[model samples]
Target: MNPRTMHSIFLKKKRTMVAIAMLSVGSISAQTFSDFSYKGNDKIYTNNPLKENEFYSPILQGCYPDPSITRKGDDYYLVNSSFSMFPGVPIFTSKDLVNWKQVGHVLDRPSQLKVEKGGVSQGIYAPDIKYNKYNDTFYMITTQIAGGIGNMVVKTKDPAKGWSEVQKLNFDGIDPAIFFDDNGKAYIVHNDAPPKGTEQYNGHRVIKIWDYDLEKDQVVAGSDKIIVNGGVDLSQKPIWIEGPHIYKKAGKYFLMCAEGGTGGNHSEVIFMSDSAKGPFVPATNNPILTQRYFPKDRRDKVDWAGHADLVETPDGKYYGVFLAIRPNEKGRVNHGRETFILPVDWSGKYPVFENGLVPMKPKLKLPEGVKNKTGKDGFFPNGNFTYIDKLTDKNLDFRWIAMRGPRENFITSAKNGVKVNPMETNIKALAPVSALFHRLQHEDFETSVSLDYKPKSEKELAGITCYQSERFNYVFGITKKDKDFYIVLERTEKGESKLIASEKITLSKAIKLQVIGERDEHQFNYSLDGKNFKNLGGPVSGDILSTDVAGGFTGSLIGLYSTSSNDIKP
Candidate 1:
């Protein structure tokens, strides 16, 4: 489909038909589904109330992307790259591939992550998590950019208990993966820096393989070799040939990597070689899976479907989970890169989606025992009303992320509540400031936080924020202009903060601040008595703070923030 058709399908001017249903199962209710559907990508979402043999689309929603999955016995474990978000590399588990729940994060401790001054989308890159049957250990390999410590690996036998400290690996390029041969030999494959610089072409990259030294925990000397250089078809000059995964299937080594960058032109290519490290040959039909080319009758525009990993169920069926984005009318995506699953049809020369995959499918069947589930404790729909206390132990939940680590000192807890000392820097600064937030998991959700902070100056503000980046965010907090203190709602888009709305009120020692997000707009509210809330004139366009609008790898983070001037003392 063309860009125009994609827009028409989602544009407000076009009266797109929306079908809704209610499905309730037990005490849990289906709270979320795809908002709108196109002609080909029609999705009729229901809060499926019954326990059935079915699964929902976008199985793991929000900005979860670059998925790496492995199956052990009847259980499946998956992990995704958490860029700049603290407690990085969220790991998930599922009996059925369709319904997944977060088990824990690989980098849950403060010492594992160090993205203080890192760029918004600069911390962790694509990570490959695998289970070594020989040693019975789970391993996760990843890269940290923007003053990061480079490539590293962490292992754990029980992911729920947490992972071990980092075993730093030396690699020049990023997007690393580990493959263990059936012979019990371990190998590492990664997207390597170009022997020839990038000016050569757009997707100029190399996939290198190395023999890993398990005892020493490093790559063996002189064992490094380039397997797939410059992607499948070098004549086309592929770019961003990254996210490589090697698998031994049918007695041959299968190598898969995402090419054509990570944007609209994104795609997946496959190569085959006899040896784990060898001169692999590309499949005749190079791009085994891609949404770029479409048949005339197809109507859905699920662009950027790349960065995939393969998994086999107990039944021996294969499936590929990749990343894709659903764009709005303006062709700007706010959802970030979401995970999409497809049946990997292996009947052909190489495995691929038989007829391509849609962004959202109405119904899918899973094994009978596999039931659709959400949340760690229960299914909490994305856009539901849930209040989180400032001092609850849930503050350390996997969903609660920080700008960086070593947070115990700055973010402290008291018997009454959590105390956030203002960092000597604003949110706009590149350096990590004192900030705590939760991912904007829903397109429409209500969030409110209680703040007892009394800002003595403009630099000592503490309240809630709808953050997109350092430059783009909507801050709803209390700041002092002079002797008079006021509750303020400021819109900071494109790095400039302008007072959009304000209300002068007397503080009762504590106040309730709220932000209600409705698709493209957000409303700010405040309550002095905790009973009634006054809308502080919001309806601010939230599209400007989206991934497409702001151009980043992370989605909006809405949570508590406190900032002071760089020179201010705590």
Candidate 2:
């Protein structure tokens, strides 16, 4: 989760966490990649393992943020914001919430997403998923900040069977959520600007409710009204009152929203109303969930906590899934914001996130009648884990994603690897390029892959990218210069690219490229015969790859990329 998007919320507004791709090209210049491995070495994960009934805090590790959850009987489905990544909205399934597995994406086709031409940070924003029991269907609504598509919705009877095409909504705002009343009435709630002239402060926003037409998939015209003005209190001129969701509890309406932007001061506040469209009053104890009040220097801190969605268990327990940043030891927003879960204490009139006001802990007690199955059997790995992908004709894992488009743009089948046809557009291109990525899931991790390729000219290059966005990233690749082969490490910050280091290497058969991250520092290395790796860019600062420094809504992606439009030189 990018606090920068939090800025967009205010204005409007991994771990070895590497999405690295492995390239294996033939000696004759036929590009193929294989034998890739990623190892998470964070002490918090390696030293501690889940007990008999315990699990980690971040059930879905890596850049899975802006979490929204819904329950269909014993089945629970969760989704997260994917920004410009193709197959937008990473969807997951869980029986116990603690053990979650990805069920593919909501927007898996290009026709459903119009983000190929926009910048990486300008695509899909906050995505809210809900279940309308009235129709026996699941709904996902979000703001596509690019390609002229504002707010839209997609539906699916079963998430595993893919979703419907984008049904453009008539509302105008971000983070739109749908609620279905037991009487079969439906309402739409979202964050929008105040009435034309009533605009007060810079970031003053309002929560508006609309009578949604379920049959037509549109909001009722002239049926919109502002519910909460400038958050819990108008006098303070609150900023970014967004990510609103409405719930009916025992004949009362409960409206919850994220306030105070998406930075260190981010928070979640709740309001109550007897009716869905009537005047909603703020709870006396607002800010029911936040880490802003906690001391900044607290140990194992979990900051920037807000933008939450709630779901009730069959046993009457309430849980919230929200976005929060786990800063590195250097206090930098490292590996971007991730999805975290906590029990909600709704025994009172209003629900409160348990232990949310204090320094957050990593261990969570398992819910009754559920076993922790993380890091095994395909449930998303949290705490610490390793992933090995031997690239084949079908390409890597299902989670290996591309930006702005599909992976078919370049990947083909090889004997034991993927045959990649480099794209004219490089990694820096805003359009679809030839690269495969995985999210950086941990603070300290090591990723390596072997490449067997011979560049024919200076135009062809292939390597790994430690990418935050197209504007800010580190590209390390092998290219031909004049008559020699060289591996170049280049860093780009805010659109400015600078060559960090490069090395001339003798290509015997294949070479192993590796990147090791120890918190704020990352090192790039290469080995000719598989062992005795030599560092290329020795300990480069990872500040540019953070959400705090780069200013975007996603995490750093490690990519195995092949591009014919190579520009970096040794």
How close is every model to the real structure, measured as TM-score?
Answer: 0.84, 0.94
Candidate 2 local accuracy as lDDT? 0.85
Off by over 4 Å in 1: 1-51, 146-148, 197-199, 294-301, 347-349, 354-363, 375-391, 414-417, 566-570
The most accurate candidate by lDDT is 2
Report lDDT per candidate. Answer: 0.71, 0.85
In candidate 2, how many Å is residue 377 off?
1.3
User: What would the per-residue lDDT of candidate 1 be over residues 274-303, giving only the tens digit for each residue?
Assistant: 889877999988687777765423433457
How high is the lDDT of residue 64 in model 1? 86
Question: Mind giving the per-residue lDDT tens digits that candidate 2 earns over 81-127?
Answer: 98899868989999889888887888876667888887877888889
Clashes of each: 9, 22
